[model samples]
Target chain A: MTTLMAWRNLRQDPIRFAATVIGIVFAVVLISLQTGMLLGFMKTSAGLVENAGADVWIMARGTSNVDQSGLLNESAYYRALTVDGVESVARVVIQFSGWKRPDGGMESVILVGFDPRTGMAAPWNIVEGSRDALLAPNAVMVDRLYADKLGVSKLGDRVEIVERMAVIAGFTSGVRTFTQSPYVFTSYNNALRYTNVEHGGASYMLVKAKPGVEPAALAERLGAVLTKEEVLTTSDFASRTRQYWILTTGAGSALIMGAALGGLVGVIIVAQTLYSATVERLAEYATLTAIGAGTGYLNRIVLTQSLIAGGIGFTVAAVIASVLAASSASSPAAVLLPPLAIATIGILTLALCAIASLLAIRKLYTIDPTSVFR
Target chain B: MIQTPESLIVEDAVLTYGKGEFATPALRGVSLTAKPGEVLLIRGPSGSGKTTLLQLMGAMKEPDKGKVSICGTPTTGLSQKRLRAMRLNRIGFVFQFFNLLSSLRAWENIAAPLDIIGMDRGAAEKRAKALLAEFGLADRADHFPKQLSGGQRQRLAVARAIAHDPPVILADEPTAALDTENGQAVAQILRDLAVKEGRIVVLVSHDHRLEPMVDREITIEDGRVVEERGPARPKSNALRSTLSALIEARRAASGDGRGGSGARQEGPRISSLS
Candidate 1:
């Protein structure tokens, strides 16, 4: 009966009800998209390390994250190979370099160098190229997304990395970095020739374990040879990378604060509207109570109305977010709609509405049946 | 005729609002007894505590220092839940404002008390239709309270109050919102419930026109009863005898007006009727 009454009451005033629902929907969509973009950017920041398929990462002593790692001796690769349950280890060099496309457009890019023969640490998701391409002299792979931005075309196109001419042999997918720069993968010797690094030295070591070897235990065993801040599992490396960008940089906090502000504004607007509606219909509620309705009934009615409005608003916002995400998929600030993010935004919006309507619920509970007469 | 016992008895009831220096007495030691098959009229000017007395009798409000019993149960010590149950099951109320749910139709309003008493919707609605038909509101059964006329609303209210067949009916100026004809029609319904069905009917009003419809009239002034008039007209013995003979003739012509002609008459028809 209470549910029925509440549904009837909402139907009684369509405009105000719709306004409340739309307000909530807008809030939900905005929050979800904002949070989704944040997560997407966070993933991009640690994309290489997160999907590197390596059991452990060996960086310089006192290294914070992969992007901030100092130079490490390439000898760390050989030292890791001698450990118990150790497998093949490869040296990986990462450095910022300038790339000049065939069309004469220049842009900053991250150059990743791996061994061509072993191909253990190569770009795993090639879109139009093979790892054997990197075996050729002065050949490199570019990310599919940034290839257009760099004004590069087919695999045979020539480009210059740090003034060293190279052929665009292929492209890799999902290799775009947090800096939104194009990624170029080359042979270790080519990277050394371009960056002028030592022949046996690199910035980090990508270590894969033998079968049945736990990454965490291997990382711990390797930590004794390296420092506590040097050796980390793939998961830890990715986590530290994301944390570095969030804490030291301004991106994470800004997005969160913006979402909070939007939610606060939405709650206040939606709550005040619902409260005013309740006050206007107070006499009707009192009449119901006078006729034998309990406080539980009134509470159910108010909450049901709030939830209905919230559901409508959240749905609208989600649809809007999806449309925006779809249109901006190729953009740097692409909105990603994960199911967990949607659910979280939904729960948050509902909580905001429920909390905002607290005063209205109290007012409903305090309505004296005798006051209707007055 | 079958004589049922009294269902409600109030003794020296005193209800006072506020306390200390602000105490305002609404009912001061007022005593009344309503037997089954009786219409008790409580009449007073505005602010004369007529409403307060009715509220007390209905157990809607408690008297500060007195006892009230309905259907042999003492209401003073009852919990609010118990009082509500008693109101739902044993006492019917018709307010002057009609108090019909604005969202419900005439039939739904009439069936509200029955619903409160836990009757199924189908059964309650069926009873409600019958009651509406009884009150000549069959055509208005599907109309909401806002769509009904003032008289129709009052009739609906009366139908709702009596739908559950409670033992006692407390009406506070049930006909005040209606015109003379509608008011007389409503009064006839109350009279039928009291005299024909043997239910205790207590009506509070300031209208002197309703006095003839009640079996007894009690006039109040400043929260106290000032005059009590019996059902019989004040007349000489010869006049009383002639009136009783006329009433007997009418009863015979009506063929058992009380609906039970096999039972013996207990007392004087009119003088002792009060």
Candidate 2:
């Protein structure tokens, strides 16, 4: 019966309830997008390293990120193959190069050259082309999402990378770049012409461990002989690259801080809405207090009202955020509202609303018990 | 020592508001009592400590001095938790403004007290429906407070006050906002609760129309009772004063004070509360 009263009270002022729900919807949408974008950027920062099929990476010493790597000596690849747990090793060359469009325009591109036969360090989200296309003469693959930015309209378009002519043979999808510099995928021999690395030069070595062998242990074994190079498991290198962007570079932290501010704004929206609605009915609350309503029961009434508002607001907001996120899945700014991110927003929205309800409960507590008659 | 069988007792209760130099007395050692099956009216002008005395009797507050016992339970010095329980199970308050939850319908407003006492919703709803039927508001049960007429709303307030079967009912000007017909109707219902239902009904109001229904009336002035007591004083003088005051109050209430005593007042009915 009390719950019925609470529900009725929520609907008693439709305009006020709508205003409250609108506030929560705005707050939730802001929080969801901010959190989703933050997670997306963090995941994008290590996209290449995480997708590599290699169990371990042998790169030049002091290599913090896979994209910003110094060339490993040609001998590092041969030395890693000698390691006990090493099953196979593939040479990979990644270099930042300027792509001069046929229209005299220029944009930054990461020229990722890998062994087409081994398929290690190759682009995986090939939406319109095959990996075998990289074997064609001067052939390369570029993300279809970044085609406009890279000034390449379609397949068979020719562009010059670091002054070397390259032909686009394949188009991939969702191969994100933290720097927003589209990746240009090609064969190992093809990359040697476009980069500073010579024919036998290797920037990094992708090492796969034998089945039942731990990559970390294999990395430790490879680290013994590769004195001038660093041997790290793929997971470790991926984490290092991710941390380098989000924490070390300060850009990621700025995004994280923005998300926190969104949460703070969310708290304020929920708190103000609930507080105003509860305060407006203070006389009714006071009457209840005088008629022997206990603190717990009164608290339940206010909290129940908040939960209803939050439930409705969150449902609408989540759907809006989810649709917004889903629509951007194929765009350059693909937002990843993974289950964890959705769950995180759900928990945060409810927790913030619950905390906001305490303001109303506190007002009820400090009120003069018999002020209803006044 | 034989104890009084009164369902409500207030013995020289003293309550002061504020601290130090700002302190002002609200109840000045006022004493009163009433047994079950009686309607007691505390009539006084504004700021005469009438409501304060009612609050004390209702166990909403403890007196600074003296004791108030309701049905053998002494309210003085009891913890707020205990007082809350005492009020929930024993005392019901009907306020001047009708104080019905505006969000709820007529039946829900009546069921509120029952719900607060931890009664199950189904049983509480059943009890509220029965009370609504008994109060001559059977059809208005589904309506909200704003939808009902002034008289029906006050009648509903009275029904809510007795929903939990409380032995004691305290009302602060329950009919102050109603017209004469509504006021008379509300007053008669309160009279029935005391005479027929065997409950103690205490009213704090200066409305003259309530005079004929009450079994006892205490007129307070400046935080003390207007006790007309002396050997030379005739007992009929008390009755005469009561009748004259009633007429004067009716004139003032009706806004025609040409030959009536100017007894109607306003604001902070409890003295020294400002």
Candidate 3:
């Protein structure tokens, strides 16, 4: 009955109720969308590491993230083979270089080199052509999303990378970097030739463990021969990459702080509106109390009203965020709403409603039932 | 096998407000009792402690000293929870201003007490409807207090007070807000509840016209009872003398030509009467 009374009271004041709910919905949608986009971008920062088909990555000592590792000698591959439980070791090189487009514009790109025969770190998703094309000297693969940006029309077309010409061998999906640049895959030897690095030496080494061997145990054994700052598993590398980007770069902190502020503002505005509505209905509450309604009963009514508003607001906000994410799917903005994000927004909306009704609950408790005599 | 009393008892009831110099006495060493099927009409000028006395009898407030026992239960030592229970189960209160909840409809307002006690909604509603019908408010059962006329609202308040069928009904100026026709109707309802149902009905009001409808009258002055008259008491010099004494006592307590002191001093008299 108390809940029914609360619902009826809220219905009676439609304008106020609607205003508070709309405020909460707006906040939830905005925060959810912004936070989702931020997280999506974070995932992109560690994309290469996450997708690399290797059990372990052997990098230089004191390396914070995979992207900032020191180069190792190509001969290190043979040394890695001598390690017990080691299956295969491949030398890879990654470097940032500018590509000259047909439109006479320059597009910055990250060059990733891998062994063609093993295809261990090859682009897993190809939009056009195949990984075999990379066998050709100076043959390169550009991301599908960046094909037009790189001004390439056909797979056979050529583009200049750091003054060295290369053929557009294929296109791949989701091959993006933290710098918002496209990735171009080529032969490790070819990448070394293009970047002017000494022959027979690569930037890093990716090691795969045998079927019976554990990667962590292999990594530990490899660490004995190498320095403590070198040799990491794929998981370790990815985590390190994420940590470096979040700690050294301001992007993570900025996004989190902005989202926090947005959530606070949203909660305050919605709560204040709800509280005002409750104040306007003071007489109605007093009447209920005078009629022998207990404080718990009255509180249930108010809380139910708040939760109802929160549920409605959260649903509307989630729907709006979903639409935004859908429309922005192809864009670099990548507004993605994970289930956790939606659940968080729902919790936030309920909390905001609860905060807003604090004053109303106190006022309800203080009302003297005998005051109705006046 | 069992004996039941018709009246409520108050032994040496002392109700004081505040403490020390700021303390103001509302009821001072007052004792009174009314028999079953009796209508005790407490009359006095404004601030003669009439309302306070009614509040004490209703168990809304406790006297600072002495015990108030209604239906043979001592209320002085009762915990607040128990006192509230007593009020809910035994006593019904009707305020001067017709304290009906503004949000609820007439029937809902009347059913509130029953609802508080976990009564089924449908049963309580049915009972409230019947009570409203008895009070001539059947057509206004769905109307909110703000939508009803003053008299209709007052009648609804009466219906709500008695909806739980409490043994004692304490009304503080129940007809103060009503016109003569509505006031007579309300008084008649109280009279019927007392005479026909054998319930103790205590009505506190300054309106002397209601005296005729009551079976007995108790008048208070200076926080003490000045007179107790019954239906057998002739309406002659004795009644006039008691009335004049009450007026003089009120004037003396006021000190000033204005009746401000009478208002301040009325609390104790009212408490005593309760």
What's each prediction's TM-score?
A: 0.83, 0.90, 0.82
Cα lDDT tens digits, model 1, A1-374, are: 44555666677778888878877776776687778778887887888887666789888777776665677775677778788977878878787788887778789888888866556557868989888878888999987778788877788988888788999888887665777566678888888887856888887788889899999999989988765338889999888888888667888888888788879878887778778878877876765564455566667768777777887788788888878877766765657777788888888888888887787788987776544331
Docking class of 1: incorrect
Deviation of model 2 at A83, angstroms = 1.3
Count clashing pairs, candidate 1: 1
Candidate 1 chain B, which ten residues in sequence have the lowest lDDT sum? B265-274
Q: List the residue pairs that clash in candidate 2.
A: none
Looking at candidate 3 chain A, the ten consecutive residues that score lowest on lDDT are A283-292
Ranking by lDDT: 2, 1, 3
Once all C-alphas are superposed, what RMSD does model 3 give against the true structure?
9.8
Candidate 2 interface RMSD value: 1.3
Error of 3 at B66 (Å): 2.7
In model 3, where do residues sit more than 4 Å from their true spots? Answer: A144-158, A174-176, A281-287, B1-9, B19-21, B34-38, B43-46, B70-84, B95-107, B129-147, B198-200, B204-212, B217-274
For all the predictions, what are the DockQ values?
A: 0.17, 0.52, 0.18
> Once model 3 is optimally superposed onto the true structure by TM-score, how far is the C-alpha of residue A68 displaced, in angstroms?
3.0
For model 1, the stretches where C-alpha displacement exceeds 4 angstroms are A100-106, A115-121, A153-159, A173-176, A247-250, A372-374, B1-6, B77-90, B105-143, B162-165, B193-199, B232-274
Best by DockQ: 2
True lDDT of residue A52, candidate 3: 73
* lDDT tens digits, residue span B67-149, model 2: 99986789978888898888877777888888888988898898888888778889988888877777777778889999988
The interface root-mean-square deviation of each model, in the order shown, is: 3.2, 1.3, 3.0
Error of model 3, residue B168, in angstroms: 3.7
Per-candidate clashes, comma-separated: 1, 0, 8
